[model samples]
Target: MKKPGRFLAPIVIAGITVGFLASAYKFVFSKSESSKQTTSQPQDSSNTSSSSKNSN
Candidate 1:
């Protein structure tokens, strides 16, 4: 019978590769998403305050 190492090594390598890719994708998209939120938040707060001021 073949040693289990032959099959297990490839599976472990593939799992590691997939995990690395997934983390990289998340890191990139999360940064972009956070930046978008940060940019939009200031404008949203300003609009809300301005509208409230106009109502007063």
Candidate 2:
């Protein structure tokens, strides 16, 4: 029987490269989102209190 061609190594390498790039992109966006959430959360809370007090 003929042996299977040895193409697996390059395919595995390409898969690993794509996986890392995808992870990096996901990490960047998630970190940005978390920072954005942290920054905006305080503003909303403070606005709510101000509007409540102003109604008195």
Candidate 3:
């Protein structure tokens, strides 16, 4: 019915919006974390050396 479609429109829009916002949060946090690690290092990028992969 027309009424149901009107109600569904907002719900669909909200779901899409939440999905986009969640992805945005993930991307920003990941970039921030990478920068944080770089800044936290004792020396600058010039002194960097090769490292080995760890299993963890």
Best by TM-score: 2
Note the Cα lDDT for every prediction shown. Answer: 0.97, 0.93, 0.78
Better of 2 and 3 by lDDT: 2
As for TM-score, the candidate ahead, 1 or 2, is: 2
On residues 1-56, what C-alpha lDDT tens digit does candidate 1 reach at each position?
A: 77778879999999999999999999999999999999999999999999999999
Candidate 3 error regions (>4 Å): 1-4, 40-56
Q: Is candidate 1 or candidate 2 better by lDDT?
A: 1
**Model 3 C-alpha lDDT per residue in residues 1-56, reported as the tens digit of each score:** 34567778889999999999999999999999999988868454434533322322
Note the residue pairs that clash in candidate 1.
Answer: none
- Candidate 3 Cα deviation (angstroms), residue 22: 0.7
Task: Tell me the spans in candidate 2 whose CA falls farther than 4 Å from its real position.
Answer: 1-6, 45-56
Candidate 3, residue 25: CA error in Å?
A: 0.6
| Model 2 error, position 51 (Å) | 8.2
Which lDDT value does model 3 have at 21?
A: 100
lDDT of 3 at 29: 100
Backbone clash pairs for candidate 2 read none
